[model samples]
Target: MDPSRVVLFKSLSKTLSPALGIGWIVAPPRWTQQLHRADQVDAQPSALDQLAFAELLESGAYDRHLRSCRQRYRLRRDTLVQALAKQLPDAPVSGVAAGLHLILRLPTAVDTRAVVTAAAARSLRVADLATYHATDDHADHGLVLGYGNLADSAVIEAVRHLRDAVEECG
Candidate 1:
């Protein structure tokens, strides 16, 4: 649900008479009645606005909007992967799906904190895997490359810088 839906629900409940909420497993007849009552009282947005909001929410608004974003991220991630593969082919890459970041595990001997500090020195933001887990020992040294907040050019450059940082440590 959108923020507006939440606000409208609150406003409607406050302004109108309070009623018991139907349980999740309500019968079809009672469910329809509840929906009808809600329609009478709910502060609904315009149909067109609602449609647009839904499109935006699902990331299926238009080809151009979705395509450009997908393409840009794909390229950025490719750049990061290529650089890492070239620099450290033995290091594994994981969790490169829908999320903003991809994980790259470094050599077991590498210091994860040192990688974080070096990336920071290069003006790159990254999360060391140790930050997410309790024990740093036996865990791989790596960085999570976040592509969502970064621009395409920035991502390419950042990945290049990352490659350099990793090479420097190695």
Candidate 2:
């Protein structure tokens, strides 16, 4: 490896480690042999085989993959937020950051179970936030809508149905 390239790579790795909360740096494999050695594989795994993928995760290969996946998810999350704000501005949505899910705080009268039931009746599935969080007095009831699997049209329709469910409950 060129000394200049190594220095540059180390500098960038140092910068990203703090941002990512990673304390250690691992060098990228330049050869298939190096990758196999890093993963501690004595033999190659076939395409149809499920090998020690978890062991290779310690090599930071999984984290590298996750970083790319996270970038895509962030874009989707932004689009979802934009759609929700345009469609249901009155609804309380939270956690518009990098994550697989976000919370929508529905009106107090909006029974989350009823909303889920209504959504299911319409051939949709959603989760209630209250079920996961501990709330004795049943504070703002809502659903924890995840955009990981939801298409843009489905999210829009689900939000619309959610608004209707709240209105119907009231």
Candidate 3:
């Protein structure tokens, strides 16, 4: 954890919108110089976007928006967690405390792909946690449920669909 060697990179893509495509980096003086030189050849974000982001920051709109987003996401996460606990009691739901998604860990006998396929057939999209692993040996059987943008009713319905899908797979 050397401070000088560490570089912090952040973007408005996640907090604001991906369409904005504006980001910044913080690094030591040497690295900053190198990055500045590289920026000359690399594609940079549009000046209009940069100015808009600056305006948002200066006006405190960005902070207000972020606070609202955090509150909304927290409520969504809680709803999802409660629905999963009630609908899929046997399965352990993890990663609900933070982030935009929750991980539902299935029993070893349960096939993650089958559940994913079944859910997809019901118009419910879910990510397989195994696909995120670097190697097959380290993979785990689980589903990544993103509830950030989903309403409370949608969260409940999605979990019910997931539960039904898992039962169908079993």
Candidate 4:
């Protein structure tokens, strides 16, 4: 990858709280200029929010919070994986190990939408993997399960609900 052509953007919304509405970007000089022009037409984050973020970073609080988040997510991810294995062995779960969410691939004959709907009825929110695709033709049958904000017991319980939903819908 050419660094000159690359732009990296990150937001505190994911790692920190969404309420912060803070983020940063690194881009080529030309891209930066264009982005600055665009920013003039768009609303920017509040000055207070930016100052709070700066203080958090300067005080080393951000790093400490990130370490805690990573540890929590790791435990949640492992718990979700184990629960899925025990509760829904037939469905294969796959994704990068470090993320807040994972994808559970259903059998080809299964209707992912129906499963999602059923899961919702049971108060367990799940996303159809196909919805993330740009086109229906490229979509696959699966569920996107996020465990980042859930407790260990909640993750297991969610997976159990998912298993029941699959059984009812599959």
Model number with the top TM-score? 3
User: Distance from true position, residue 161, model 1, in Å?
Assistant: 1.8
lDDT of 1 by residue, 51-150 (tens): 6545765775545655776787788888777767776687889987766688888887777678788889999888888787777464456777677777
Better of 2 and 4 by TM-score: 4
Taking all chains together, each candidate's TM-score versus the true structure is: 0.59, 0.56, 0.90, 0.85
Clashing pairs in 1: none
Quantify all predictions' global Cα lDDT against the true fold. 0.66, 0.64, 0.86, 0.86
lDDT tens per residue, model 3, 10-80: 98888988887788888888787779877764667789989988999999999999999888888888888
Model 4 C-alpha lDDT per residue in residues 1-170, reported as the tens digit of each score: 67799989899888777787788888888787789877753667789989988999999999999999888788788888888999988888999474788999998788899999999999998999999998879746899988766776688778888899999987
State how far residue 6 of model 3 sits from its true place (Å).
1.5
Candidate 2 has which clashing residue pairs, if any? none
For 1-170, candidate 2 gives per-residue lDDT tens digits of 75423422222223232333222223444544664466644453343322334444668876786687677677778777777777667676887763678887776666778888887777767788878867656665777888877774566676677666656665
Worst 10 residues of 3 by lDDT: 36-45
Write the number of the candidate with greater lDDT, choosing between 1 and 4: 4
In candidate 3, position 14 carries an lDDT of: 87
- Can you tell me which runs of candidate 1 are displaced by over 4 Å? 1-64, 134-138
Give the distance in Å from residue 56's predicted Cα in candidate 3 to where it truly belongs: 0.7
User: How would the candidate models be sorted by lDDT, starting from the highest?
Assistant: 3, 4, 1, 2
Per-residue lDDT of 68 in model 4: 92
